[model samples]
Every structure is written in structure tokens, then in C-alpha cells.
Target: MKIGIFGGSFDPIHNGHINLALSVIDMLTLNKLIIIPASSPPHKEISGLASKNDRFNMCSIVANCYDGMEVSCMEIKRGGKSYTIDTLKEIRSVYKDDEIYLILGSDMFFSIKDFKCSSEIFKMCTLCVVPRRAQETDCIREYASFLRNIGASVVVLDIAPIEISSTQVRERLKSNRDISKFLPGNVEQYIREKRLYGLGGEYLIKEYKSILSKLLDKNRYSHSIKVSEKAIYLAKKYGVDVRKAELAGLLHDITKQMPDKEHLIMFEKYNIKLSDIELKNKKLWHAISGALYIKNILKIDDEDIMNSVRYHTTGRENMSELEKIIFVADFISDDRVFNGVETIREIAEDNLDKAVAKGASITIVHLLEKNKLIDHNTLSAYNRYTSNFI
Candidate 1:
């Protein structure tokens, strides 16, 4: 059996790495390719590098797409300066009968002479030189010829060049560019949700979670989590950004931590003009207060998220997609226990407009039955939907 050994830092393995793995497997017609993610790369600094676990996880993510490819954490398990010589010796011990091939790019091929126990490495396996499109073809040929002169076995394969790099991936994520085009959907989702590589680095999501935990009561905090999950589901279904939806949902009830008097105080502090009936209603203050607190205190400038938190309780007319999502999410969250909740949730599955209109109508009727004051925005929101849909 011919086995290929492909190793790299795979800091944040991108499409290019996946392409290379696929090409090498097909070109060599290998039975199995063992992909090694470096635990501690001696050549490169580990400052911006992802954790060993993350790198290994990303490698596994790519390996899943290609048959006969496997991710081995040998280097990581070995720990401390992942020397190629050691890895080869360990593999040699396992598969004594199989023909081993070591895959490297043109860049690595040129510098292999400096590798620890370089001579012993060649004896262990044939150095498969995968030419990078960035380098000159003539230079690659000349290097291959030189390696032959020095009595090293080398196989140069002509593979389609995919120009993506991990650096480019990191840069795109840092700048908030659309990197979905360059990464697998699952990998992209992991990076986005974990706020990896500075996508949401400006604000510490965990820090906010901690602050929220300290502020909100147990029940209210649980409700926030439920709303966030429901909002994320809706966001994904409706093609809205899931990250934004989650954040909006988390902050939607930020003011719920405050007492009734504090909500009233926050309302007046923010210069909000509430109706005579709304002034006495503490329940109506959290939505408006949450929006203002996150915007002013948290310094969040995202209007989509701000509006989502603002209108989550009392949805307004001509609401944004995010606004509608939060409004529906709050009403149908898992913690909610009321009549017709299941009906609105079912309606939400197929029709957002219908759900929003129905939810607003239900809230209005509930308030009227109690002889409570209804906010004008809430009334206007219902009228807007009825006039348009009806």
C-alpha cells in the first residue's frame, strides 16, 4: 500500500489546503494519506496561531470531504518542536511494509535541506514536490534536477493551483469580509460563532455574557438564551446573519435585570416620552431600555441589532428583518407559557408577516382585556400589518 504523509501548521486550514490534499491523493493514487497538524511548529512563530486543538479540528474538517485522507495528531501528542524526522520514525515503526510518500510544497522542497535529519527523512519516504503557482516553473524544474543530482527521490506532480491561503482567510475574517466563499460552511460557522481571528474581536462576547449573567435573574437569563437560539434559527431560515441575530437576542432583555423603578428611571433618563398608561407599565420599559443601554453603555453601533432589541417587546411599523425575527422569537421562546403560543410558532414556521401580525394582535387583545395602556407604536405596528396584509 502507498501511504502519503502531508503535514503542515494548518493554522486555519482553508480551501487551498483542501484542494492540495485532494490533488495529492488522486495524483499519487495513494491508498491512504495521513495529514499531520503541527503541535508546535519550530519554523513559524505561534503568536497568531490557533490552539493545537483548533488546528486539529480544522484539519479533521477538511479530511472529512476526501476519502483515504486522515488527520493524525502525532505532532501535537509528541509535543515540543514537531520534527519531521521523529514523525517519520514513528510512522516507519507502524507501517513497515507500506511505501511512504511525504508531500511538500515547492517552498518547503527548497528548504528541506535544513530540516533536522534531512538525509534520513529522504530514506524514510519519497519527497513529493507539489509545485506552487506562485513560484517560477523553471525554478521548480531546476530544483528537482538538483535534488536528483544529490541522489534524493522526488516526484513533482502538476496540480491545479488554488490561490487561497490561511493568511488571506485570517485577513478576510478580521476585516469582516465574506469568507464563506473560501471556507467550508461548518468551518466558517465555527469561526463566526467563536469570534475567532478578530471577526467579533472588538467586543468580548464572553465578557458580555458574564455581565448579563450577573445582571439578569435566573429565569430572565434563561429566557434570553431561549430567545437567542430561536432568533438564530429564524435568522438562518430567513437568510439574516446568525451572529447578529444571536447577539441581538442576548441583549434584548438587558434591562430586565433592573427593577421596575429603574426601568422607569431609564425611560426618563433616555428622554423617551411614554403615554400615561405606558408610564405606569414597567413591562414595556425593558425593550426601549435594552436598546438604549446596549447602544450607549455597551457602545454597540449596529443598527440592525439595536433595532432588534428595541422592538423585541413592542414591535413597530415597517420593522427590519432582524426586528421581525426578535419580535417573533421573544413571543415564542421556550420559556413562554401562554395560550396560542403554539399557534403563533406554527404560523412563524411558514409566514413571518402573518406571525408578526398575529402576535401583535394577540398582545393588543391581552392588554385590552386587562384595561392596560397600549403603547402607540405597538398599535401602529398592528395597524401597519393589517392594512397591508388584510
Candidate 2:
């Protein structure tokens, strides 16, 4: 009996997973396909993940609908970090005589060489990959050659590339938006029943109250409120999403009052890899960690808002309209006073584009003059945005 292995975090199974699995079965004529959920993905911090049991149960719910598909708790039951080689070896043990095929996305295919015992995986099974829509076939062929050179049998299956991704699904779920089209009806219902990503609004409100009640200095809290008000104002001015800008502004300093020690703890817990500058300053970690905390604990689902909060202190490039609004609002809020305060306020009021470009240019020049590392994103923003001014 030929068997296929499909492995993923499967946080909440969606139609994309089902479509990919069916495509593989049809293309490979595999007798059975095992859907394995990882116990813990080594690359990511697990704190943000749904419980292992929850992931497994969701995969099980999706798999039971198909006759040839079965959900395996093998990785979840094994516990600890999951490696593909170990799971493949286990499957080989169970179906000794059967040919095995590993089904993976085109994105995962590029990273195969980095996986634990990737070479062994190829020797044990034929690797079946579906192409991603945006990826070039030439790139796939290049990697396929590299794999073949390493003694791996690579098979590229032709299937309609599903653009749906778990990240998009998670984002949609957080907004209390309809995910029925992206996900299976049952899985969509299950997520709502469990209330997985619905905590953003309440969490933000609670954190705001907590900051007001305890951690924040009165002045800082006042600045936060002003930033929030300005952010909402700018959101209206720019026609960006208003609710997201308000939430981002309100929570931008959620961790500002945390003791340095507590802030560092959150950084470690979130696995936020700091740049050399960020590591040296330590102060900057609060913004990055605060964004993650809001996302994980507060369940903020709007990426634009979360990113705005994260990059508010040190603005980065290609900022969304919302990100730019929050960043500029933080700079020119009524409490702010500086050499260019009046000019910045005028530019902001009359033309936000000029304000953003001027603000970003000022920040870049300041960082350069101070001999500090300018964040690449900030520079990118300046380059893309400054062309209009020049």
C-alpha cells in the first residue's frame, strides 16, 4: 500500500489543506495519506500556538471526512519538538513494504535542506511538492536539482496553487470576520465555538485599564491618550482603518512601565530576536515585545495595527497608511515639543504625506548622526516616500 505524509502546525484546518491533500492523492494515486500535526515547531515560540491537543483535534475533524485520509497524533503524542525525519522513520516502520510520499508546499520545499535529516527523508520517501502561485518554476527546478544531487527523489505535482494561508485565516478570525469561504464549514464553526482569536478587543481594553491603574506614569498615560486621539484623527484624515489605529495608539506603550527585567522576560518568552542596536539599548525591546504581547495575549489580529505599535518608536519603511498614521501621531501629539514641533504640526494638519516624509527623513538623519543602526525598514520607507518630495 502506498502512503502519503502531510505534516503541518494545522492550527485550524482549512479548505486549502483539504484541496492540497486531494490533489496529492489524485496525482500520486496514494492509497492512504496521514495528516500529522507537530507537537511543537522548533522555529517558532509555542506560547502563541493553540494547545497541541487543540491542533490535533482540529486536524482529526478535517481528516475524518475523507475516506483515504487519517489524522495522526504521532507527533503530538511523541511530545517535544517534531522533526520530519523521525516521523517518516516511524511511518516506514508501520508500512515497511509500501512506497511513501511526503506532501509539502512549495515554500517548505525550498527549506528542505535545512530540515533535520532531510537527506534521509528523501531516501525513505519520494518528495511530492505543489507549486505556490507566486513562485517561479525555475526556482523549483534549481532546488530540485540540488535535492537530486543529494540523493533525494523529487516529484513536482501540477495542482492549482491555493493562495489561502494560516496567517490570513488567523487574521480574519481575529476580526470576527467570515472565514467560512477560506476554511471548511465545520472547522470554521469549531474555531468560533472555541473562541480562539476573539480576545483582541477585550485584551486591549484591559491592558489600557491596567496601564492607567498602575504601571504608566501619569504623563506617559496622558501621552498615550493623546496619541490614541491623534491616531484616530489621522486615521480619518488618511482614510485608513480607524479602529485599528486607535487600538494601536492605545496599546503602543503597554509595556513602557514594565521593569526592565520584566520587559526582558517578555522578550525572551516571545523569542524576539533583537538587532544589535535593539539589544544594546534594551529600551527598544519594549515596543517589539509589546506588539507580540498584544498579539499573543491580547489577541490583536490586525497586522497593520500590531506593526504600527511595534515600529512606532523607530519608524520603518513601506509602512501601511495605518502604521504611518500611528507613527506620525506619536511624534506630533499635543504633548510633543521639539525644534520642529510647529512645522511638523502644520505639515501634519495640511498634508500628512509631507509630515511622514519629513518625520522619516528626520529620524533617519538623527540615527545616522548618532552613529546608530538605522533600521532597514525605516530607510526603505524614506527611499520610497521621499521620491515625491525631491
Candidate 3:
């Protein structure tokens, strides 16, 4: 018997996975292809992932579409961290005389040597790598050398490159964007029917509620609600997507009141490397860190919303109208009573550029009076937008 192994997280198997499987089967002329969903991939963390059963079932739906493709719950049933060597060893025990072809994408192939028991695993199965996109220029020859060093049989198959990815599909779904073109018809319908990706669902509201429950200060919560209201209002005014604006507003200050240690930990966990200035001025980090927390925890995919959160505190050049609205709203919210805030608020209602310029000027003057280092974004925003004030 001839068997081919195709393994992945299959978070929600999309067309790209289907295409890769089909291409490999046709290219290898294999008798059977087993689709294995990892129980837990070692390299990547599974955040916001559906249950193992959900992922396995979706893989079954995709596998049944082709005659030669078969879905295996081997990794899921094994019920611990999934490793390729253990999977191959199990398969070898089941099919003693079969020739095994481990089908992998170019991206995964480059990191083959890092797999657990990689040397022994290569001895058990022949490696079949498909170049889905650009060649692995960074370390292709090095990887090949490492694989051959272990006396492994390897073949690289060239296939039509499909740029679609599960992350891109998930992000599109999160934004209520169209993904029909990138997913199987049944799979797409299933996701929609199940209210997957939280589109038009109460999941986002629930997440907001949970976050709010942890916040003790009623005033801070009120400010968050006000920012959300203002963001929606400005989004409508600027013809931007209203829901995205609302989400950005709601999550912009999520970390505002967290302890410094907790905030730093969150930043590090999310891979947000703060500069020395950012670390010293904890105020600026809340915006950047808050944006990352929302994206990673709440799974918000609106780049406009994320960027709005990122640059909310430090106004940036060429900011989208939405970002400017959030920035000005935060500066002039009802609780605020700074010296020229009223004038800035009045300007914000009519002209965003004038409002942003006034706000940036205020921030710059205050920072200068305090002898603080101003961020480049703030300086650029003041220069570009202050022309209106002149």
C-alpha cells in the first residue's frame, strides 16, 4: 500500500488546504492520503481555536470531497501534544510494508529538522515537499543538507501557489468580510450557519462584558462607553465602517488601569516589544498594548480598529479619519476640562484636521512644558495638521 500523510491544525480547513491535498495526491499518484489534524502543534499556540471535535469534523467535510482523501482523528484521539514522529511510528505499525510519503508545504519543510525525533522520523518515511509559494530562500539548502545528513529520501514537488491562509480566512470572517471565494461551499455555509467567527453574534458583547466586569472604576467604564459612542458617531460622519469603530473604541482603554507589572507581562506575552521611551512613559503603551490584547484575545480583525487603538494616544501623520476621531474623543471626553479643550471640542465637531491640530498642539505644548520626549508621530501630526491652524 502507498500512503501519504497531510497534517495541520485545520482550525477551519479552507480551500488552500484542499488544494494542497489534491495537488499532492495527483502529483504523488498515491493510493491513500490521510488528513491529520494536530492535537496541539508545538510551534504555534492555539488561540481562539474551535474545539478539537469541531476542527476534526470540518476536516472530515473537506476530506470527503475527494475520493482518495481520508480524514483521520489519530492525533486528536491520541489526546496529547501531536508530534510527527509518533504519528509516523503508529502508521508504520499499522501498515508494515506500505511506502509512506509525508506531504508538507514549503514553509513547514524549512523547519523539519526542529521536529521531535526528526532523525528517526525521516528514516521511517519518504519526505514529499510541495513548493506552494516562493522558494524557501532563507534556509532551503541548509534544511536539505540537514535532512540528507540523516539519510532521508526527499523530493520537492512544484505546484500552483495558493496564497490563501487560514489566518486570512479567519480575519475576513471576523470582519464580516466575504470568504466564499477562499472556502469550500459546504464549509463556508457550515461556518455561517453555526455563527462561527462571532459574526452577527453575541460573542463580542459577551467578551466586552467580561472585560468590563474586571474593571472596578465606574468612571473609566463610562469613558470607554463615551469613546465608543463618539467613535460610532465619527465613523458615520467619515463614512467608515461603524461597527469596527465601535469595537476599537470599546477596546482602546482595556489596559488603562492594569498594574504596570501586568501591563508589561501582557505586552511581552503578545510579542509587543516596547522601546525605552514607551517603557518609561507607560501612558503610550496602553494604546499599543490594548490593540494587541483585543486582536489576540477578542479576535478583532479590523485593521482600522487595531491601528486606531495603536495610535490613539500619540497622534500620527496621515491618520485615518477614524483614528483622529478616537484621539480627539479621548482628549475631549465629557470628563475632560483642560484649558483649551472646549475650543478643540468645538473644532472637532466641524473639521477633523483643525481638531487634530489643536489637540496635537495642546499635547505637544504640555509635553514640552513637562520636558518630556515627544514621539515622532506626535511631531509629524502637529506639523502636517497644524497648517490648518495657521
Candidate 4:
């Protein structure tokens, strides 16, 4: 059997960590990838670190999403500073007949010589180094050659550099910055739910509201708050995840006020290609840009929430429960006082599907009356939900 060991101080596992792990497992073709979270890293200062259990739980949350990936509390259970040689020795004993591969991030690879029992660590397992930056590839390869000369096996993987760091993630969380793009949705949610990283006393909604207030004008901010409340009510009625619904609603219009140039710049930065219709429709820019902002900057890695934000303005076919809540919430939020709003609100209370159909029909008719272009997603939604009408 081929086994891989990936140990780290996964104080809150982020996308960078996940990307590296997946890369290693795929490249190495390992039978299993054991994720060991360090209880106490010997070489680094352990300031503001999360509790052992919280770290372990966060790692477990991410590991569960991938096959052949498992989290071990060995270092945590050992109750002291974690040493690589000791971990490798323990792992070797378990998989006596199996080949062992040890995965190391760029920092750890560069500083391996300073580690305890470094020579023994090299002999025990093949060292897999993933460079953190493109510029460091040559240096990393040179060092890997040095290791090979000293009878140590080394492999440098050609993976895109992992740009985010745990320290960066902590900094963002400390300042109430959005990290949805940096972390898995569940992991970020776990960090917020547990109030880790000095985020105590400030609830998730309050933090989001603070950030939203800065991004949006007073009217838009007020509308977001109302949408959040309405979404929560609808979530309760529909059995959707209330917090997710609230978050989706609160951030649905995050980039509504961004200028066309800014949105285009963001699209170029993130490599988001736009369809012909999407390029022409400036009104639809917010949903696309806002979802990207939520993912790439705010680092909210929840696809459902991102999609809810992306498609809220133009409802799509086969919308999720949370998506429906936000879509309808936008139409009937307290701030909305347009004609026929009361009827949609009444329809929403009894049947969400009907409310969505009614809402889409209203939007389509309104666009037709004004000779405005209808979004393809809106048309698709209308076709899907109003089949009986046809």
C-alpha cells in the first residue's frame, strides 16, 4: 500500500491547504492520505492558535469532503511539541510494509534541515515539496537536488502556487474581513460558529452587516438588512438553512453600486469570462461580480450562497430552496413598494414555487413593457416553473 502523511497546524484549513492536499494525493496516487494536525509545532511560535479540538474539528470538516483523506489527532493526543521524525516513526510502524510519502509545504521544505532528527526523517519517507510561489520553483528544485545528493529522495510537484496562508486567514478573520473564498464554506462557518480567532461577542450577521454597510449606500444597506430578515422568515417557513438564507440575502447585492469599469477589472483579475448577453447587460453585472467578490475576496466558499447571490436578480431553472427564499425576499422585502407586491407576498406565504413563477412572470412582463432585454436565466426559470400555464 502507498500511504501519504500530510501534517500541519491546520488552525483553520483554507483553500490553499485543500489544493495542496488534493494535488499531492492525485500526483502520488496514494492509497490513503492521513492529515495530522500539529498539537504544538516546534519550529514556530504558537501565538493566537486555536484550541487543539477546534483545529482537529476544522481539519476533519475539510477532510470529510474528499475520499481517502482522514484526519488524525496523534500529535494532539501526544500532548507535546510535534516532531516530524517522531510522527514518521509512528506512521511507519502502522504501515510497516507500505511505502510512505511525506508532503511538505514550501516553508517547511526550506527549513527541514533545522527540524529534529532531520536525517532520519528523510530516510523514512519520500519528501514531496510543493513550492508556494512560481519564483521559488528553481530554488526549491535546487534544494531538492541537494537532498537527493545526500541520499534523500525528493519530488517537486508542478502545482499552482498556494497564495494564501493561515496567518493571512487569521488576519482577515481578526479584522472581520470576508474569507469565504479562502476557506471551505463549512470550515469558515465552523470558525464563525465557534467564534475562533478573537471573533467573540460579534455574531456572524453583525459582522456581515458591518462589512455590507461599508460597501453599500444607506438605502442599499437598509434593503439588505430587510432582505435578510425576510429571508430568515422564509427559511423558517421552508426548512432551509436559516443562516445561509440570511447571508445570501444580506450579500445579494454586494457589488450593486460598483462602476462598470470596476466590474470589468474584477472579471479580468479573476479570469471570469462573460457571455454576450452578460457583457451587454450592465444591470446584471452586480450578481456576477458580487458572487465573485463573495468567493474570491470575502472568501465565503459556499457555492449555494454564491449561486443565490449570482442568480437572485435573474432566477434560474432548478433553484435551490435558499435561492428561492432570496429571490422572493428581494421582491417582497419591506423596502419594496411597487404594484402587486402584496399579491406576491401573499403567494410566497402559501407556495414558494408559485411565488417564484409569479415573480418571474411579473419581471418578464415588466421588461417586455419597457422593451428591456430579459436575462436568459429569468427566461429559463419562467419556462421551468410556469409549465402548467403553458
Candidate 5:
């Protein structure tokens, strides 16, 4: 029986890894191909690498799509810098009589001679090299001849090279670019769910839900979720970034439940100075503290998102589309049951400015009716949006 050992960091396995594995299995007629996710790769930096479990799980998802491939936790379980020599020896011990092939990318193939215990590794398995591109073939062939002189058995795979890399995939994901062409659907979904590569996708919503669950009561938590949904809808309608809108809406009321003392403490700690009206208006404290908490404590350094949260309660001048989306979303979220919520919601469907103007007018009326001091920002927001407001 011939078994192929294909190993890499697989930090969220992409389609290129899949392409190489399939090519190797077909070319070698291997009975099985084992994908080993390196826990700590000796050749690469460990920083920004995904957890071993996540890498292994991603490999497993890709492997399950094919007939002859499986994922191994051997290197991950070993818990150290993964060396090819040690991994090949472990496989040799298990499949004593079987032929073993070590599948490698061109980059790793060239550096094989420099690996730890390279001489012993050459003796254990036939090396199967997958070129990174067509141009590297002649260079790799020359290198293979050099390895053969040192008693290494090598086979260069005759297939088109996959031009994708893990680094490219990570970069695309971080910048909110679509990765469907580079990865399997399941693997891409797994990365989004895990929030791997610093992606602000559904996983961020899950994280925010957990945080809100602890900080807010049942109603407020539910309200936050509704606001997030409403914000997504409005963002799509208004051509705003949905991720920013979702985050701003969900966290807009993050500090809403804090008592006056807690709000004061946060204000003091963050060196936030409030106007006399802002200090007197407890209703406005959450937006102020929420913005600071997101910026300073949560360390979300996006100025747009911070401003959206800061002014979600009391709309400010020249608000961005995201800011208006969150402000209107908070007022017209599914959980909002005020007397005029339906009218504002209706207005929001056609014109965001009108909805904001109407919502601000309602807020001002409510504050006045209750003899509450309204924040100046609210007045500025209303003035900016409406032409003829009393």
C-alpha cells in the first residue's frame, strides 16, 4: 500500500492545498493521503497562525470532500515545531511495510536539504514535489537531480500549479474580500464562524451577543439584536458597509444599563468631559460611555464605528451613512414599541434623513414632556436634517 503524507500550517485550508492533495493522490495511486496540520511550523512564523484545532478542523472539512484523504492530529498532538523527519519516522513506525510519499510544495521542496535530519528523511519516503508555478519546473528539476545525488527519491508532479497561498487568503479575508474562489464553501464558512484572520463576520455578531448577554437585561439584549438586524437592512438600502452598520447598531447601547455612578467612573477614567446638559441628561450617558468603551477598552480603533456609537443616542452634525443607519435602527428596530415607531419605520424605508428627522423630533418631544434636559447634539442633528422644525 502506498500512503501520502501532506503537511502544512493549513491555517484555514484553502483550495490550493486541496488541488495539490488531489494531484498527488492521482499521480501516486496512493491508498490513503494524510493531511497533518502543523502546530508550530519550524520553517514559518507562528504569529497570526490559527489554533491547531481550527487548522485541523479545516483540513478535515476539505479531506471529507474526497475519497482517499484524511486529516491527522499527530503533529498537532506532538505540540512542538513540526519537523518533516520526525513526522516521516512516526508514519514509518505505523505503516512498516507500506510505501510512503511525502508531498511538498515547491518552496518546501527546495529547502528539504536544509531540514533537520534531512539525510534520514530522504531514506524514509519518496518525495513528491508540487511546483508553485510553471516557471519553477526547470529550477525544481535541477534541484531534484541534486537531491537524487544525495540518495533522495523524487517525483515532480505533472499538473498545473495552484497560484493561491495561505497568506493571500488571510489578506483577502482581513480586508472583507470574497474568498469563495480560493477556498471550499465549508472551509470559508468555518473561517467566518470562527472569526479567524480577524474577519468581522457572523462570528463577531456571536461575540457581541455574548458580551451583551452579560451586560444587559433580557429586553435590552433583544433590542440590541433587533437593532443590528435593522441596521443591516438600512445599510444595504443606503449603500453603507453592512459590517460597520451591524457592529455600530449592536454595540450602540453597550453601556445603556450602567448606573450613573458607573457612567461617571467611566467618564473620569477616559478623561471625557461632558457639557452641563449632557451631564444632567442620564439618557445620553450610554452613547458617550459606549463609544469610549469600544475605543479604549474593546480596542476597536475604527473612528467611524466609534462615532456611530457615540452619537447613536443623540445624533450629531454631518453624520455618516453608518451613523444615521444606527441612529434610525435604534429607533425603528423590531423591538421598538413606541407610539410613533411605525411612522418612523415607514419613513426609514424610503428616506433615511426623514426618519432621522422624525425620530429626533419625537425624542425632543419626549424629553420636553418629561422635563428632561436634551443634549445639544440632538438639537444639532434635528436642525441639520429638517428644514422647518420648531
Candidate 6:
């Protein structure tokens, strides 16, 4: 039987890690792949690392998502420096008759000379190294050849480059950016629910979205999800904080289905006083009301996030990038089949201001045709766009 060993800190496993594991297993035709989470990594510092149990559990969660994949607490259970030499020795002893292959990324392979009993590692298992994109084959082959001269069996696997790094995932999570696309849905939900990465409260996205769905009709809930997706797209395009964009888009219409009386009651309870024009225009009530509810009831006090929700409807002058992202996302959401939507979407990809201006123009035209009131902010946004972007 052929067994593969893939080990890492796996602080929180992401999709790229999962994909790489799958690729290696398929290429090597290994009967079983063991994923080991390190208790302590000797090469680099894990300053804000999660607990060993959390890392082990996360690896288990990810490994369980696939067949032929299993989690091993060998490093964590051993309770020391998490040396691979020791782990491999233990693994070899357990599966004495099995052919063993040790898998790692090219970066890790380059550092093998420093590992304790480095030569002993090769005697125990063949080394399979996955190269990073832009890592030249000549360089990899040269190093692999050098290892061969030293009695080490080094095989470089030409796996597809998944341009994701654990460092990038951690940084995005720390900066309040949405990692939904980078992580499995269940794992994302787990991280959010556990309040990992300092994202506390209703920041627990999936549960909050579920609660919102119950409060909304199917169509509206679908729209909210689409808007959230589009918001994230624009956020990435513009380098805005995606987490804030998603939250603003998701909750932008929380108060949309409510009657005027309900908005009034919420406003009164929150002690929120609106302008005469805002009070007269019932359509604009939801934005301010939603902002109030998010901060007061949900206890999310991020000023930028609240502002994004507050201005998604009418859109204030000099809005934040996140506000611009949500406004444009909500306007150009996938469910919106209005004329010029395709045009606005194309423009929004490279020119956000021009797209928002086009959206504002469309909203203004519809209001005029119905002889409904238009907010000054909407007019200002249109003027701003036409003057600067047209």
C-alpha cells in the first residue's frame, strides 16, 4: 500500500490547501493521505496562531470533506517542537510495510537541508515537492538532482498553481475582508461562528444571513445574496474592505418590507431624527433605519460599515469606497434586469464612478416617469458622475 504524508500548521485550512492535497493524491495514486497539523513549526514564528486543538480540528473538518483524506494529530499529540523527522520516524514505525511518500511545497523542500537527520528523512520516504507558480523548472530540477546525489529520492510534481497563501488568508481575515470565496462554506461558517480573527457578533455571516432570509421573502433574500456577491466583487476590484461591503449589501434592505409605521417606530425607538425631505420620502427610510438597527440591536459599531448601509439608497456626497461598492452592487445586482444594467456592469468593472452615475441616472429617470420625489444626494451623485466621469 502507498501512503502519503502532507503536514502543515494548517492554522485554518483554505480551499487552495484542499485543492493541492487532492491534486497530489490523484497524481500519486495514494491509497490514503494523512494531513498533519503542526503543534509548533521550527522554521517560522506563529505569533498569533490558533491552539493546537483548533488547528487539528480545522484540519479534520477540511480532511473530512473528501474521501481518502484523514487528519492525524501526530505532531500535536507528541507535544513538542513538531519536528518532521520525529513524526516520520513514528509514522514509519506504524506503517512499516507500506511505501511512504512525503509531500511538501517547493519552498519547504528548499529548507530540508536544515531539518534534523535530513539524510535519514530520504531513507524513510520519497520527497514530492509542489512548485509555486513562477518557480522555474530548471531551478527545481537542479535542486532535485542535487538531493538525488545525496541519496535522497526527490520528485517534483507539476501541480497547478493555486495562487493562494495562508498568510494572505490570515491578512484578509484580520483586515475584515470576506474570505467566503477562498474558504469552504462550512469552514467559513465555523470560523465566523466561533468569532475567530476578531470578527465578533453578527459578523458571523451565514447565521446572520439565515436570520435575514427568514425575515425576507424568497426573491428579496436572493437579491440580498446577489448584492452581497457583487459587493465583494467590486470591493476586490477597488481594494475596498470586502467584509464591510458584504455586510452593508446584505442588510441594506433589512427594513425595506416594513411599512411606514414600522420605520417610524424603529426611528423613534432609536431616537433617530430625519430631515423633512427624508420623512416625506418613505422610500429613503430603510437605509437610515437599517443603519440604526445594525448598531443598536446587532451591536456592530463599525462606522464605515454603518455609513455604507446608511447611504446605499440615496448615496451621499464624498462617500467611502465601501459605500460606493455597495451602492453600485445593489444597483447592478444579478437579479436586476433593468435596461442599461449590462452597460453599467461593464463600466463598473474599470470605472466605478461612471457606473454609479449611470445607476443614479436610471433611478432618477424611473422616479421622474412616476412623478415621485428624488433626493438631493441622488441628484448630486448624478451631477458628480456626469461632470467628472461622463
Highest TM-score scorer: 5
Query: Positional deviation of 269 in candidate 5, in angstroms?
Result: 35
Clashing pairs in 2: 316-378, 317-377, 317-378, 317-381
Write one digit per residue (lDDT tens) for candidate 2, span 186-267: 8776765565655445445555667555657888888888998899899898888787878788888878887888777887
- Winner on TM-score (2 vs 5): 5
Off-target runs (Cα >4 Å) in candidate 1 are 202-390
Candidate 3 segments exceeding 4 Å error: 137-142, 200-390
Lowest-lDDT window of 10 residues in candidate 2?
198-207
Relative to the unseen true structure, what is the C-alpha lDDT of residue 194 in candidate 2, on a scale of 0 to 100? 67
100 Cα displacement, candidate 4 (Å): 40
Model 6 Cα lDDT, one tens digit per residue, 114-164: 889998998999999888775566688899999999999987888877878
Question: What digit string (tens of lDDT, one per residue) describes model 3 on residues 1-390?
Answer: 789999988878998888888888888888999999988766566466666787888889888888989988999999878889989988999889999999888777877888898888888999988776655533555566677877988877767768888888888888767788899888877776566655554446556856865862788888888887887777788787787777777777887887888888887787878777777787897888788877887777778888889999988999997788888878777777779988987887888888888888898999999988888888899998987667
Candidate 4 structure quality by residue, lDDT tens digits, 34-85 = 9999987766676677898999999999889999999999889997899899
Cand. 3 Cα-lDDT? 0.81
Q: What CA root-mean-square deviation does each model show from the true structure?
A: 14.6, 16.6, 16.1, 16.8, 10.8, 11.2
The best candidate in terms of lDDT: 4
Worst 10 residues of 5 by lDDT: 41-50
**Between the candidate structures 1 and 4, which one is better when assessed by TM-score?**
1
> What does candidate 5's lDDT look like per residue over 1-390, in tens digits?
999999989887888888888888888899999999998876576466688899999999988989999999999999988888989989999999999999988889988998999999998999999889999999999999999999999998878988998999999888777888999999988888777887767556667789889999999888998999999999999999999898888899899998889999999998899999988878889999999989987778899999999999889868898999999999999988889899999999999988888878899999999989888888988998886444
Instruction: Superpose all Cα atoms of candidate 4 onto the true structure and report the RMSD in Å to 1 decimal.
Output: 16.8
For all candidates in order, the CA lDDT equals 0.85, 0.81, 0.81, 0.90, 0.89, 0.84
Backbone clash total for model 4 is 9
Candidates in order, TM-scores: namely 0.56, 0.52, 0.52, 0.53, 0.59, 0.54
Report the candidate with higher TM-score, 4 versus 5.
Answer: 5
Q: How close is candidate 2 to the true structure, as a TM-score?
A: 0.52
State residue 322's C-alpha deviation in candidate 6, in Å.
30
Cα misplacement distance, residue 170 of candidate 6 (Å): 1.9
